[model samples]
Target: MNDSLHTVSLIKIALYSAFAFVLSVITVVFITPFFPESAHDFLRFLAEVGIVLAVSLFIVRHLNKKDVSLRSIVGDTSVSKKMLLFSSSLTIGKLILYFLFAGLVLRFFITQPEFAADAQSVMEDTSPPEFNRWLIISTVVLAPVIEEFIFRGIILNKWAEKSSNTRALIISSLLFGLLHIGSFIIPQFIGGLLYGIVYIKTKKLIYPILMHVLNNLIPVGIMLIPAPESTEAFSVSQLIAELTPVLNVVSLVFIIALPVFLFIVYRYSRNLNDEVAPFKFNTRKAI
Candidate 1:
């Protein structure tokens, strides 16, 4: 505990993440032997309770830490038009960045032979109707709630108290990305960065949580769109050209609109003083 808060928070993040993942894996291993596939799948979902439980523990421990309390996560969230405008613009900005990074990876970096497995895995993840529904719900709903609380609420909150908000953003975002395997890590990290910034500027947990949910929904929405059935097979590049013209258009618009969004964010962030204390109890905080 004498260590720098950033260091301490980082270690705790790794420990709890590993604990949850190992427990989930163990649960899957145990259930695979005794239960049918569907039953095991459902049990696997419950295994995620380990993460939820672990996060709850983090919340308590973090709150009890000296000079820190619950205020790090919760803040003023007035339902005024100004707040709504900031939220909407922040949400769309994050989405644009999300697609920008993802498209860059797909269009250029993923073309390498080394990434063939990664690319193939992405394509093969084509959704079945019912399972995709549950998957979307889990990713878009459960994930945002659980993850925003854990990353933005607990990890970033703790770090912000211990360090500057900028450090908190970078550290927590890196940890967020590392939670995933393979190519997922980069985009997830980028998302964590944007989410953390929004949480800092608005001091509103809902904005980041909403952004997380929206980010997840992007991929799911893409999957749900019925692809035009074709007899001829296409290479990844050709398929990208065919299926994702909208992504390119959006990326272009994102480039054009990014400065405008930043101006709006800056206007809102005029009073975002990082030196202010981060975690404390406030009974009537707006955000």
Candidate 2:
């Protein structure tokens, strides 16, 4: 378990992710065609879960080959109720920041008819009820668990062993953000960083996973709000106008609450650390 041989390289991480994605795609393609359209969503979900579980096991076994225990990677620290509460409050602040920034981008797009058309198209694409249902399950449920395990539970700890915690935080967050690609890059990246910090401070994989689920809940809740059944074409200004007031109020509240939440979390984290040292993986140990 020499440091030289302990690294989880970026290429390996990319390959692992791509392998899961490609395997899921292949499974869906091979299996879904035989099922009735009514059953496709459920079947697809099963396929995704199956593939992810299989890949996760494979990754764990691979790590075990190098003497890294899954328990160590996931950490041994106990999480407290107050810590979870403060962390969740901080996550709300992050979500508000996202919505405010999204509002700004929408406002900018309001000035450009061409961009508005593209935005309209994207909205239409996602408006399907079936798509929204699947998106909710995927985003709010599966993604937090799977992505947190891969990025924070595994990648961050291994990379910290190979390099340093700071570098591990930056690189893992960067990879997480890049996974979203396109316009989601910045927000997802920042979210990754926040989750990474929580993982480091709490030394518990469940904290970040729970926080990630909470962060996604707000957006999915908004998406689930029933829109008027209008046959009329989309209007960017109308959309912005309807959303602006709520976003502004929330953003203002977030601005005021964020610092308080940070202070509480910081204080609690310090107490937790004093009680039990934040677990670092034993990369130097061999079975």
Candidate 3:
């Protein structure tokens, strides 16, 4: 087995994820209660930063032992204006399609009250106002950097050493989806796949991170929008129930349009070599 693949095996990836989850639980269960409620969010944010740092240090230490610098795995490819625009457009189109399909499936196919409630629970973020700042910071900033580094930079590249890039992409993206399993699994899975593709095409972590930021920013921006006073407290289920008819029509349109949109994405992805990769980066050793 190659050194990179051996160092970052699937076992290590699972351990990394488990370590983060256990640490988070420890923070919430043990640490958060001691703090006044006002300080909980700040504490959680610090915990998140610590988790990222801890995981990163572990990865770096292992890779160094293998003589592989993190930067090489991350790649030093410079993203050009043209590649940036192309990647951004592709991400936006896929996101719109995902939103439509998700709405359709939830509103129409999944009709049992129990199942619907479970789905709604996944979508709902009931964090109080005190936590909003940290939530936003984590989602918009910490998430993209750490997640992209772990999934695309370390896991995907390491797996690609011993397996085909396609297999590595599927494995990395599947793990990514599971990380957000309860909350719109399909969309997260699709986003993972898209980010994986961007990483593969450009050989750069920055590209996928940029796309992830854009993906996350959309929901963050939506959350920031002031709702109508009357419906401010409505949960996703209630809102969906109220707008069922309109959503059904929109879903129908999306169902019809989805195939065409997918075809465009496929074509664009195939032509990415022409759009990106006109330049290259000399890989020097760096963490």
Candidate 4:
């Protein structure tokens, strides 16, 4: 494709992503309030997913019409299997690292000692009847798939087109981090960085999806595990105190293991360029 055409395609993608983001925000803030709390939450989640997917699909279609595709965005596919393996490994490694980070931060650095107090408060406040089932669907399935499609698929794709790989990765990752501007901001930002690195290394959406799914799943799984009851009303400090001892040991183990895992992933991904070249070409041709 010509530079002019590529520029046009990129503009379309940016417009679509921006539109989806705005729509999602509006849905969450206003449209979601009419239904029952649980129903509203579920619907809002679905709406957000829909917006991203719809926008991404539109961009893909636009690209296809101009005879471009993922291949054009990613270029040649060599070592895809290796890339996949490395990506999966990196996802696991990062999860371990982040979990440990979250634990340690809660254990020591967080002034109030309620490491994820805000998240905990939201979860408690939004407790639904089938909380476990809903939580699994939202975290493991919905969040991972949809968020990856939006951040890695549309946003990163556009960034890669307009800038160097390093720039694209950093900008997209920063956007990912900033989007999670809530009480759990630090941990989410760390998670975003990990996901962005995997996306850039693999040039495939699946890696980030797996990483995101695991990131959400681990926390929800921990929440599912039974905990001792305290008579006092839940306070952030109290919650941190309850989990501090267990978190410290878990964090230490994960922190130790993460670097080893990351090294393996890095080594594996080094061979990916050659493997992905053919696949990328074929995909471009098909488009």
Candidate 5:
């Protein structure tokens, strides 16, 4: 594409993303109140997903002069055994680090009474069972795909055109972190930063998608596991105190295995790069 055309495409993508974000915020703030809390929450989640997908598809199609499909984003290459191994290794590594940070570090430092109050205020509403199901789906599936497409696929790609890969990664990562503002902001920011690193290392949206899916799935998976019931709400300190012994053991094991997992990811990513190079070269030539 010509410089003028590329510039125009970049602008359009930015505008569309901005519009989608604004629309999502508005829907959450305003439209949610008109319906029952649970139904409203569910609808809002769906609306956000729909808006993002629609906007992204529309902008990419108009700018690139081609249809934007999942296949396009995921690429046409077969998932080789090596790629699977790498993805799995990287995913496991990420989960371990995430748990260390979220379950241990953040949980320890950010456990002030004010922080707990703020967190409670944000989660004030009692979402219905159906809403909870939709929330889970949105978080675990739709969110990971759509967000990776926008942040890594579009934003990072665009920035990489005009800057070094490292610079692009940092900028995109910061934007990703900033985008997570509100309740749960700290953990979200840390998650974004970690995903950014994964994106930089793998140079594929899939790495971050896997990381994201695992991040969301871990909590959802925990919720699925049966636990002893208690009538009273558990304080942050109480929960931490209860889990400290188990968390310590898990952390030690993860720390020991992390380096090996990182090495596997590095090798896997290299293989993926080798496989993708020829396709990228051909695509460039065709363009």
Candidate 6:
């Protein structure tokens, strides 16, 4: 019956996700036709920024009015060596996990025709360099901040009030995936789950944001690399081997260490601050 959990039921989660999705789709359907083809990407990006920001901020503000406070989610925590290692390891693990799964999908499931079309779709990013630059900045910087604030800082924290950390993490992570609602759903769902766990463990918004930024930047960096058509023939394994043996070694290390790191993080997260009093801001309403 706590206030934080009151506004954040499974029903509310579904409803919020539906609202955001419908609104985004409606906005796109109505607005995109009016824009000239040349400026569509830029305009769509702008619309997305405005809509997602407005919607998320409004929802977060209303949720914060309940038992969940910004202070609790933002919990005065500083970056440390442990946090850095944890974030780095988790990010690396996520990359390896995603690629490994993608490799399997590409290897066994997607037919030659599908692969050819996929490669074409991937290669056809004919956007100007300037547009690519803006896209990178928006995804790498803005996405982390906005997404972490809403999914972790607001929704996850609120759910945690009356549920186990595991339940809250699952709910928030799924909600995060729901927001993507396309080809992004699977990877984002995995990333969201890991980020949720990181947020719960670190008890800080910055760590998840940092992890998200780093995760996103990896793909952008890869995209900036020149990929010739010849390379398209390489399977994921061949590609990995050809790219760098060192990366495989690193991935192996992360795969082995993922469980150990998760255990350590879980242990650290379970330690309550019973001895030290909870942080208090100026007003009772704030906490």
- Which 10-residue span in candidate 3 carries the lowest summed lDDT? 276-285
Please report, in order, the local distance difference test score of every candidate based on alpha carbons.
0.65, 0.70, 0.73, 0.62, 0.61, 0.65
Q: Candidate 2 versus the native: TM-score?
A: 0.74
Residue pairs with backbone overlap in model 1: 75-287, 76-286, 76-287, 77-286, 77-287
Question: Any idea how many clashes model 5 has?
Answer: 0
Write candidate 3's Cα lDDT for 111-213 as tens digits: 6667667757765755544326887888988899888888887777666666666777788899899889887577777888889877877778889999999
Candidate 3 achieves a global lDDT of 0.73
In candidate 2 the C-alpha lDDT for residue 157 amounts to 68
**Tens-place lDDT digits, model 5, residues 157-200:** 55655665556556767777777766355556545655655555
Encode model 4's per-residue lDDT on 59-100: one tens digit a residue. Answer: 668766765545544433345676666565656666667767
**Compared with the true structure, what per-residue lDDT tens digits does model 6 show for residues 127-174?**
544435656777898788878877877667656665656777788888
Candidate that scores best on lDDT: 3
Cα misplacement distance, residue 24 of candidate 1 (Å): 2.7
* TM-score, structure 5 vs. true: 0.65
Model 6: which residue pairs collide? none
How many steric clashes between backbone atoms does each model show? 5, 0, 0, 12, 0, 0
lDDT of 6 at 133: 66
Per-model TM-score versus the true fold: 0.69, 0.74, 0.77, 0.62, 0.65, 0.65
Candidate 6 stretches with Cα past 4 Å from truth are: 1-35, 60-68, 104-133, 184-186, 228-287
> Which prediction has more favorable lDDT, 3 or 4?
3
Which window of ten consecutive residues has the lowest lDDT sum in model 1? 277-286
TM-score result, candidate 6 = 0.65
